[model samples]
Target: MVVLTKRELEQIALPAVQLAAPPLALVPEVDLSAVEASDAARSAAARAVAKACEDHGFFKVTGHGVPAPLLARLDAAAAAFFALPQRDKDKAAAGAGGGSPPFGYASKRIGDNGDLGWVEYLLLGVTAAGAAAAPVALSEGAESSCFRDVLDEHIAAVRRMTCTVLELMAQGLGLDDEGVFSRLVLDRDSDSLLRVNHYPARPEAAGEPAEVRRRLTGFGEHTDPQIISVLRSNDAAGLEMSLRDGTWVSVPSDTRSFFVNVGDALQVLTNGRFRSVRHRVVVSSARPRVSVIFFGGPPPRQRLAPLPGLVDREGGRRRYRDFTWREYKTSAYRTKLADNRLCYFETTATS
Candidate 1:
């Protein structure tokens, strides 16, 4: 990974200037209940998804059919795990499933680059077995067993939802193969991942109000490098997305729903028709914030390019040059979080 200069890191960590949040209803919301409905209703739902992808690249989903109790269990498990002492968490890191850089627990530091944030997270790779083996459940003890069980069940449900939306995306594009996108994520060698983030509350109890203090960067700005991201969070909200005009707006916190966003890979696959929404999390509240994201990625060896159907051949050549998923993933890992990672792979003439 390219190391960032201290100056660049400082620039990235500068306090975020927050704008007033737009109305909640302004963000597009799609009801996935249509997925199981009549063909006409499904078609309408698909159209809605397509329009949202083109216009905002960020939206919410309702009637997604995920079990409420299961989500609650995972939330409770996450809370308990975060509440553990620093030493305990550090010890649990050993069981975080070894890797080159290692997949375990991380705090403050966002990446190999000098990027920093007021956040701590557990990064775990999801496998063909359908789950991520993270720090919490290493032993066969009851507590450990319960944590792994709930985490696994939660991922299974969220993974299904993620695939459903991917299929919807294909349908929205009027593709004959609705599974075109979903199949990549469902592949046995898919490089999916789960990231559990915890942004602790400000240490100040009796100080200036939240508004008086400058906003702290929880997670700096960036677009996910996968195909799609399904996010679940508690009531606390600090999420923000960059509008097409480069304006940043607060995302309304919805505890009962899931927020889905397009990623860089998806943008490439669609020939840049769908945006890869740039987003960040800012610390504006004193309450601790917890969020878990399921990133749906394809197999490393999978070749990535503009889908022939999505590319308007009559108009011109593809927007992005052909490359394997592994190539893109490697390039992403070697860049700063806020960099336009896709710029390296785009066709100069097309851009």
Candidate 2:
């Protein structure tokens, strides 16, 4: 487990610009079924997904079989969790997760360098047992049992979808059909963490016009560093990703679909075959927004590096030096999260 001191988190540098674009383009609403069959279609899907990943590192997935009822229940539960009074929410604050760096509630505006994003969060991690251990149920009282049941179902569905998408990525990268998923996601302690976020609209003053302060929000530009991230956002739009040419594009929640993005860890395991896009959320003045993300990855101590096959062969010689995933993550977690320089190192370790 890792713990981030207030001083350490306070030292991180925010993006130089307040609103920056991500590094790619977004291929909105892709059908999961269309890409699951035939080598040719899979190849094409791979190419398209790869291109989108390379360009923006983020895309929208649709036609996934996750039941709509599940999504509704999850969303409602998320709302209930965030709706708790500040005091109740603080009961599960970050430090309570036995010193784990990424769990529990995190208030907005506490990040390094005064980067003020308008959101609060409660983070959860899943173990191989197929369910996240109940660190602290929303409420021990039965009134919130529905929240627990619905959230449990939603997590299961997200885990399944995560495996399906990762398998496709493996096939697209020309590895064995079950390649990446098995290697990157160890069944026992794979990271299937969840981040339940609340992006509050900018507060209005007593008599101040509400419209003037309506456009504030939840987060700033960044990318997930894990394998894949499945996210569900409220109607308010603030999530944005970067493009290859350096433009940040907005990713809005559509219908019942969840937003998916490739993370830095996957890029390394695939030897840079895929990319992790930069993204951030903005605060709003009306209607608070809540989002939950399921992050996929190996255990904390797993050594992460680009697959040798993707490294040495055709194009450029191996681009990064091999390093343990935990080592790299430790550095990232210890320092400013924006510094991506060390994530790609070159060394003569393994093939």
Top-scoring candidate (lDDT): 1
Per-residue lDDT of 349 in model 2: 50
**Native-referenced Cα lDDT, model 2:** 0.65
Q: How well is each residue in 1-351 modelled by candidate 1, as lDDT tens digits?
A: 113345544554444445234333378999998778798988888999999999999899999989999888888988877887776666555666554344777677888876788787878888786787554534446766687788788889999989889988999988889998999999999989888899877445236664465566789899999999999899888888888988778898898899999999999999898989999987656688899999999999999999887776526668899999999988988888899999999885541
Candidate lDDT scores, in order, read: 0.81, 0.65
Q: List the lowest-lDDT window of 10 residues for candidate 2.
A: 1-10
**Global CA lDDT of candidate 1, please?**
0.81
Q: How close is candidate 1 to the true structure, as a TM-score?
A: 0.91
258-321, model 2: which lDDT tens digit per residue? 7878887777776666777776776543567778888887776777766666766645456566
What is the Å distance of residue 170 in model 2 from its true position? 1.3
